[model samples]
Target: MSGLLFAALIVATPFLLQAVSPGDANWGKLSEISQAYGAVSVPLSAAALAGVVASLAYQARQTRIAQEDAHRSTHRELILLALASPALRPCWEPPFVPMTSAEWERIAFTNLIMSGWENAFRLGSLSDDQLRLTLRGHFSGAPARMHWANARDSWIELVEHGTDRRARDFARITEECFQAAVLAGPGVQAADYFIPEPTNGAGGGGS
Candidate 1:
């Protein structure tokens, strides 16, 4: 509304001046000045209109971004609730793994963490390198590794069956992380496996 008013004011200012000035003064000079002002005002009005259009475009884009963010947040919350609730156990619980309640909880929580990471990646929160590094560090641990080992096949099947194509690359990334963890061998620290070399041109190394 303010933008429309401002544009209207820009377009109307010259006419208002023509109406308000002394009517007795030199009409010839006033006519020339009015013509000059009109020439300048034409461009000014065009620029104002362009600005209004650009502003509307920007606002629309922001609204879309907000809506997408809200949707992602709501979706993430629903998934978490379903995972934690006993009522939804049959929906996602791994049947192949015969484990204690505590172990199953850990596995489920690890899957939740991976899902969150994948969601962030899909939302452009994490770049390829960032996601890779994060997964490498995380999956280096035994619990995360165990969870991925049991869940990888199902995740890959989902990707292959046209379930959320966005997670397709994520499956590959996590698999790479799992493979790297295996190659690092037992008892190898995440820092040692994922960050083996010195950084920032420093010669110091990790134990």
Candidate 2:
């Protein structure tokens, strides 16, 4: 039986038994028996009730603490993931380009997109073509993409076209994207899409 119910029974049994007892002409003996049972039942019931309440409260507190810890752990993992990403590094360092409001907006949007892409890749839901298409859409008509593409064309042009610091910054962003694609896990087939196949003696080559 449940502890609460058992405690209730302990408290009630003495009174119930007393009520049903055949009373003698003498009231003293009856009073003595009643007092003896009452003394045991009252303390037992109170102790049982206190124990049940304390156990319940402790369990609730533990559950709350576990949930809070899990939330903090997940948050910490996400921060680590962001730091491991190559894209955010340039923004943190100096010869700092003061990003205009528009540039910052684009950077934020791109980072958000990259995060989603990484998650999708990890979950085995992203395709190379889809990744390429999404990137193309985001990069179109933006300084971010223009800067990146210019850096990819040639190191000499990259140095000549922009401030040395900006060129280095663009290189880091490009490298981060490449690294993300490679490290995105077994679900991603980034090499097929991003990396070119070595030419074979035959006309056709495969990655």
Candidate 3:
């Protein structure tokens, strides 16, 4: 009986040792796999952060470009206003009447108001005879002979008392007229019809 038991113990010992060793090896391999995954995650996270930062920078550049475009557009509108003012007839001196620089500036300012109002009417922002009627009504009590300065002051007064809607409409019409005048060229005639004076020298005639 002792001999048979000893033989059975020897067979079972090999099987037990094999099972314990495989379990320990598997646990070690799992730990190594976990460590590798942890190492890979750090690089991926850093790459994602870089991508997010790059996207924000691109958006900021686009916003800056849009703002600059708007500023340039406003500047262009102002330039058009300057160019349109010189082309109007009331701003010009007649062949017989020579005007001083100050006189011309005053006339130009007055004409600018009239031209602005007339353009507003033509654009359908104001009625056909609205400005004319307003002026007539204001000056009805005054003398028949009125200077350009008086007309300009009266127009400015009327504008001040006018609705905010009219003011906005006038601004819009002014921009539109300026754009049209620019496209038509400096020599193109508008409603006021100012003929350009002949150039005397390389410097060109005074405005």
Q: Estimate each model's TM-score.
A: 0.50, 0.31, 0.30
Question: How high is the CA lDDT of each candidate model?
Answer: 0.77, 0.55, 0.53
> Can you tell me which runs of candidate 3 are displaced by over 4 Å?
1-25, 86-207
Candidate 2: tens digits of C-alpha lDDT, residues 49-149: 99999999999967965785587467556545545674654554321245554454444445444545544543357655565555544443344343333
Per-residue C-alpha lDDT of model 1 across residues 12-71, encoded as one tens digit per residue: 987897798887878788789989999999999999999999999999978966886788
- Considering every candidate listed, which one attains the maximal lDDT? 1
Give lDDT tens digits, candidate 3, residues 52-78: 999999898679657855874665465
lDDT of 1: 0.77
CA lDDT, candidate 1, residue 184: 90
Clashes of each: 0, 0, 0
Point out the higher-scoring one by lDDT: 1 or 2. Answer: 1
